[model samples]
Target: MTDARDPIVRIEGVTKAFGSFTALHEMNLSIASGEFVTFLGPSGCGKSTTLRILGGFETPNTGRVILDGQDVTALPPNKRNVNMVFQDYALFPNMTVRRNIAFGLELKGMGKAAIAARISELASFLELTAYLDRRPDQLSGGQRQRVALARALAPDPALLLLDEPLGALDAKLRGQVQVELKAIQRRTNKTFFFVTHDQEEALTMSDRIVVMNKGRIEQDGTPEDLYFRPASRFVAEFIGETNLLTGQAIGRDQDVTGFDWQGNRLRAIASPGVGATATTASLRPERVQVAQERPGTDNAVQGRVVNRLFKGHRMLLDVAVGNTVIQAYTDTDRGRAIEDGPVWLGWNANSLTLLAD
Candidate 1:
């Protein structure tokens, strides 16, 4: 088992470029021995590039990659104790399930008994003992993914890198395999660095997440921290569905500020460094509460319901305030059932977050 006290991988000031187009900037990060960290972002955002560098598939133009306290920046793929599970599963067409799982051991020149023992251990963990002789073509999508995972684990690498491992599976199969993947990770306790563009998958599987944008690290924290407290405008909008109300800053103090959205004035309880200029109020749709009549509060706005959508147990309302629209989620049985009429929207003072211009 890997030591839990030490960081298994340390990447410092890593930069990669292809001609004039830079894929990764001088990014610095650390992954603990058994920690499951995910790199989340949109396409061409350098998340895959960073993973490639860590796997020794691509060399960085600047800075160093330190694995297990040793600088392995110049090491080739064969020398590094890291294995990757590709998006396609990348199983050999002619190889049976047993051969695919034992291929890595054969490359390392292990005895037949040793290879068999390792494959048996992995098959039991992944519940693939019955399908040991089946080929990739004969197994289902979920079974193929498990075989890929078992192959990666057969070599016992210090770190396992997954590059969109579930992208090929259908929605229902993805959910089922996701549970299996998490269970396997917990049982092995191997450091995992997963790269994916799916936010829901990242939030559900990762212990911590690193959000990237334009080849730069936007934010890095626990899933709860990123969901609740985003560091920038891009992060707040990218991480989840949020209601962003842009307005001119009308009032300010050391600890509080106010902004004007349309003709409506709203109070903001935000950081002490919030400036008086063009700022935004970020709130989740679920945080917004709707009332038939205006509530007597410091932050309430009068608007008309333009449209309503029934989303099973809850309802979504698009409240129109002059030209601006805000989305609010209301329970099916809660407060006034919204019709195409005038209504009031109320959000708590603390929920209004004043973001940088």
Candidate 2:
């Protein structure tokens, strides 16, 4: 959450190129104070490049980097009021956790009593009171991560930059820390610029997510918006599991669109600027309903059950509709209707979305 005050950071018309390869193309972004924004994309998608440019680690070829209304594009990393937490949690193995957290405060010429007080505050806040005397090598991976985060926060920078800080932990630990990090951000009310290739992580922690592909931004929206209403094929495919149906447009009626897919006439909700000739539709598995008889719905098709994957409470079924396979999910007990034979799949027209790509 953030106040209505102006954005704390802004990147305008930024582009970065190395030799013949372009990393970022006309990157533009604005982040308000206390807003947890995530830069999510695959490798070489310019997410990290954008982060480095904002943190003053790399200079942008053309554009302005404004931090709290002051341009800092040409300033060095240390000169800017920003701190980055590296993926490896670059902590000093030889120093105790208290000393490590106090390193930045010491560099800023803080008094002994003030530095000690600040260390005490961070130690209690990060739940590292008992481990204050332990070195980085003596602490657990999660503790080391917290120590690194505490050290970065000790400086009290205007913005915090995190580059996949949780990549080193195990799956369970990573999931647990994601919640903790989000809680910390809300409590501290500090603007965070995080970069990661993990979709689930981005969805779990961000107030807003910027989806990037190749060398540009694809979509910027809330987690639910990007997951439920993707703007392009790349965003629809990258955000989560989806079934893409490609066909020619048959007709359009306001929001609903009729299309021909593998000789079957299906209808879906069309996006803005969807052409009348050919297009693609995206459908989520959980929205597809499979039954023994065709339900009276706007869209229905017959298919043979080819595969079923059970996951305790729910199950995923792969129904072969002619040559194309459409996947659906149902409750374990309700899934018995399409065990292994021909079945009818039906879904509301509003559930399916016509993609721009």
Candidate 3:
């Protein structure tokens, strides 16, 4: 068994460049064994490039790739003890599900009996026993995805790299597969390095999220950490729907920091190194409570509801506070009652996060 304390993959000062364009810059990350670390970012943001480097499909222009404390920078894909599942579901069209999954084992020179047993085990685990004889053309998108996963996992590699494996599935199926995938990861205790631009998917599946932007890692933390305590404005804005209020840190008291935004005073959780100059505070829409009467909170603002959107369980309202519009969420009843009139929005000081602008 792999040691829990040891990181399975160590990316040390890795940088990638394509001629004049740099794709990744001095990237350093350590992924522990059995971690579900998702590389999240928009397209052309080097998430895929990082994954490729790890999988040995693309080598870094500088620095080393280490696996289980061994430097593997010069290793090829087949020699790296890693497998990747692509967004395209890269299955052989003519091969049966069983055959597709067994191909890797066969190439590894596993005996026929061992290959059969491995395939049977994986098929049962993935609930693909019934569809083992079917071709990729006969399977649904989710089923094909499961087969692809089975193929990747068949080798029982030390690391599994998934590059948006659920991108091909429909929304409902994608959600279902995400739950299943996490369950499988927990059961197998294998390190998963997933790459995707979908923030929701990253939040739902990752043990830790690495948010990348423009060839660098903006932030790396748990979903709650990234959402509730974002390190930068890009992280706060990229992770979810948030209101970034531009302000200046006036002073600090205990754990709370005071801010001045457009002649309004606000308070938020304080951290070290926050400058006195202009900063931004990220407030989640759900954290902003709306009511007809002013609620008892340290910070409360009055504004007219400029726009409202019904989202089944909750309603999203855009409350115009001066020239800036603050987004708030409330239950359907309260949202419907407020309509287009004036409303009171309140939030505790702890709910606000002071971020570098």
Write one digit per residue (lDDT tens) for candidate 3, span 155-225: 99999999999988899999999999999999999999999999999999999999999999988889998
* Weakest 10 consecutive residues of candidate 1 by summed lDDT: 269-278
Q: Over the stretch 52-131, how does candidate 2's per-residue lDDT look in tens digits?
A: 99888899889999998789999998888899889999998899999999999998999999999999998999999999
Would you list the rank order by TM-score, best first? 3, 2, 1
Error of 2 at 181 (Å): 0.8
Report the C-alpha lDDT of model 1 over 17-57, residue by residue, as the tens digit: 99999998899998888889999999999999999999999
Clashing pairs in 1: none
Selected candidate, larger lDDT, 2 vs 3: 3
Best by lDDT: 3
lDDT of 1: 0.87
In model 1, the number of clashes is 0
